[model samples]
Target chain A: MAFYDSLFDSLGLREWCGAGDKGGPMTMAELLAKSKGTTATEETSALTLPFPSLDNLHAACEAIPRTRDMTSGVENFFLSIKSSLQFVLDPLTQPLSWLLDGSIWLFIAMPWWLLIGITLVAVYWITRSRASTILVAVTWLFLAFIDHYDYAVQTMAIIFICTGLSVLFGVPIGIAMSKNDRLQKAVIPVLDMLQTLPSFVYLIPLIFLFSVTESKLYGIAIILYAIVPVIRLTDLGIRLVDQDIIEAANAFGMTARQKLLSVELPLALPNIMAGVNQTIMMSLAMVVIASLVSAPGLGVLVLRGINNLELGVGLVSGFCIVILAILLDRVSKATLARVDVSQDS
Target chain B: MTANVKVSIKNLYKIFGPAPESVLEHAKNGVDKASLLDQHGHVLGLKDINIDMKDGEITVIMGLSGSGKSTLIRHFNRLIEPTDGQILIDGVDVMTLSADDLRKMRQADMSMVFQKFALLPHKTVLENAGTALRVRGFKAEEADVEARKWLDRVGLAGFEDHYPHQLSGGMQQRVGIARALTSNSAVMLMDEAFSALDPLIRTDMQDLLLELQKELHKTIIFISHDLDEALKLADHLVILKDGEVIQQGEPQNILLNPSDPYIEDFVSDINRSRVLRVRSVMQPLKEAASSTAGNVDYNDTLEDVISHSDGDTTKVYLVMHEGEPVGTLCMKDLVRALVPRVPSEESIRS
Candidate 1:
């Protein structure tokens, strides 16, 4: 019935193979116990199994594991650990929900004019460039004229909180990695995987772990997708500082904390700021994908358009997201240019 | 003279490798640097280095690149720990000090100037100069006042608010010197502090250092590759080769009577007439020489005496220390001193 049935019989494996007998599935333990008695007799052929013959063996023996069984086993293991994993992570991640909810409420509840005025002033103060401030103001007004103001504000609130959390946690991890070679060697591969993995894959696990109603369900997905660049750039920035200057800091008898705060951090700021700009852009990208999990904002409209075949809704929402991205990117880059002293002669 | 010893390095050995302690015996047993590296995969950084630096004098360590002169100076501040050695600074064993005490010593007792002028790029000149004081927890205003005084003294009065990158190489190094001075440390370690400057600026900095030394009287350890700079600045000169001290003493004594062929080769091409002072060449006299041409200061170079005598080989001049005659110099001895001693024929063949 199977390609491997006769070959297995010639090898004196017939008894273990469940040959010519239809049977239900059996556990791997019972299969191993039956196979342990297999021996080559005088009439048995001394032949090896060919490559990729495991599927044929599964067809011949009902006791052998099928590919689907292997996948199910993995799923079962994950399910076994899910409750314990949730028990530990739920407490640690609870505050992220509070931060996300609070910011979204505040951004939407503010008077429209007040929000616009305050945002423009903040951008102007950060960049000290009139061109960047004007770009942000115009982008916001266009979105408001099209009735996309509330959605844009919600997206901005998410990006702000996610980027802030990324920096708050990412910088210290990067600093610790820079100071220790062992820690750096261990962390670099993990960061590489996080950066290269498809952004949608981050949401798959978080969705299973947290309820879709909680803000942290999408918050965790966005933070995980966005945090990689800040960590990598912060580590690289500290490593790139001039060795001569580090020696001078040591020569001044600076304590470890003092050297890091006064010398290393100031020198590494421009690189970290560049990383922050990238993080903000990444957070906006992930927020759209996270709208599949009921995340509020422009992404929700984009999802609605896609699901319902509303070309105008999807196209306009996509255009609005692009506008928000450009505004954030330009403002942050202008601020970085101001902070980078080496750009001057 | 022994009581005046400010810093003493005794039997120091530095082997650089993964397992330096495992190969320490090989380095200690007089193994050559090359063989040690080839046999045990270790670099011999320094070997049995011993030198006593005196207080209120500049000890210039001169060597070619890779001679470990830079490595040697860092040991004083414990920046690079010696594999095996005892360093005594102000009569305290530097190796025995705790982390806190060592930081205190570095902050209050010793300061350094780097060859690359390692000023912070973001900070203004005033802030860079005051870094040492600020690190020691001095108030920002207090540190600024101290930093400003030294910056003014170094002729950087109006450039306090300018960033380091905005200054020239020489001016940045002046900020480095001002930083060291602001700390008011008793000992200064200058690692090729003028090597990065232009030739003209280098000369000006040398003169500035000598002038400052007259008033400060700090025990300074200077590292340089230039023999002319060494002869000009060093009260005690130490020459190194292959990370071992070849000869060290008064610069004039080392030049006049070089004991090794390496030392002989190093001093042969120097402008002897300009660098050799009258005090080193003159014959001491209890009374004034008869028929002396005129008076010459003991510190005058042979070039000065040559111009003063107008190339008169027969005329003799009394060497004056302060106002009294201490010795006499003749043009014949001056001419003889101008020629470097020929190396032994056997030394050349080897």
Candidate 2:
């Protein structure tokens, strides 16, 4: 270890240490530190790598042209393409913006009693179990009493829109990927980079391209971060379709489009729905992170808690997020269960 | 058309590789499947296959695994493309059809029953049975009615709404058959269609298929690895080995006069008495305007003829079809047919 440290030292990275990149650009390491606690000192952060020589490695990372050049290049790339991308994207994303804005307004403006009553009825309709439905009603009422109703409602609105958009585009792309092997091979690595990149890394390029004030900024981040599950599961669902079944469809003279609609999509519904459930949860996960970009709701409060170190504010909002997750998860999962039961019968 | 030849294969070859077209010359020149793969990178899936399937007959192609029997059947619907071949069905070359024409060919001319009962797990049995019609733009109600008729025909009338996973394997295969029948296509492809069923259920399905065939008279092409199944279902039998048809004719003829050692080995262990029809062994009609001990149908198995004769050696029987004399069968010829013929080569060598 000492020999390796000395060897790295001779590479002359010492000058780059403590250059103080104080703009708070938020590295993947900072995200980790944020998750643990928002109060880790800069000195402690230099210990991110497990090895003893990580101090030198950190300084070397800043000095390394490969690392610095790539990061800055990516940000610039996103910035340069912003205008054209936004133009092409606006029409496609307008519906998404409308859905997000419309839903948020509707959720926030509804009376507390009306909202709670509607939620209860919907939950009962799905689960048909008085017990689960009551649990839902009580959870919502608890939020109302705690004065977190608007925040919870705001979070739900974002989740609903982001997940809806993710499924809308993700399923067809996944189906296309399933049909074409070359496309699947090419697109899978892009999906992998999207998924495996640090969750916070998604916001950086969008922040550079779209102003922090734009609703589309966080909306895009939530979708890019959350859409992976539905795409993966939809692809898996279609690919896992029985080859013999496919041959039978072919033998029966089904056109490709007919086969997809009648056989592949129907058979793949359960897996796709499961994928939707995960996408919804992932959308919620991006909630607080997305709040950093001026997106509203419970996440804003969590960010407030972190910035001001207000334990009560952070913990309360975190509790509301959990409540929202469990409620959304239960509803979608229950619906998926119904689909599975119908399949079995 | 052309003496009732429903489908014809003309010098078909299937070489599985990136450049099967480039290797066609070698495969055409009798390069064996093994050497094609070992010497070159191509796998010879089928080689020089020529067959004529008549209308209203079950043409059963029999081969062990990797003999390309399955590959050959798939070519009828163009599910598997051939390297060099022409497949003409009903006097039209299927190989030349456009995508829409090909789809119409499959929808109007062919339907298939699978070995594993490939019923959609999500759709109800009725919906599955109606699938072929639904694909052809039939109204849901129209398709359902058509499917229900065949479902009843296949003895699955009341189980329409049940999903596939709810049914047993045998019952699931019944749905597969019902689906094929519901399509009302001129051609039915059964790729080892009964090979996956229980033994008792397999026999029942076979009988069901035969009963349906007698009434419908569809041009059926069946692929099977089982010699017994091939012998039982085939009206025109094509025996395949290593992607080549070794010998094919009436099953009884192949059993009686195996052209080579490979066929001899195939028929050697077969119970010939159960397979050989009396017409295969009966003497051509000699105009004896007289009565015989009994009347036998031309399609009667030799076993049935024996039981009709009641073990009497002197009894002579008239082989009839539709109450008309086709041939004469005596007890002597029946007993001789019971004995397996020793090939001339084997006898000479011994």
Which candidate's DockQ is highest? 1
TM-score of the candidate numbered 2?
A: 0.85
Model-by-model DockQ, in order: 0.53, 0.49
**lDDT for predicted candidate 1 compared with the true structure:** 0.91
Q: Per-residue lDDT of B16-80 in model 1, one digit per residue for the tens?
A: 99999999999888899999999999999999999999999999999999999999999999999
Q: What is the lDDT of residue A167 in candidate 1?
A: 97
**Which residue pairs clash within candidate 2?**
none
Off by over 4 Å in 2: A1-98, A124-132, B287-293, B310-314, B324-326, B343-350
lDDT of 1 by residue, A193-296 (tens): 98888988887778777888999989998898899999999999999888999999999899999989989999999999989999999999999998998889
Q: Which candidate is the best by lDDT?
A: 1
Every model: Cα RMSD to truth: 4.9, 7.1
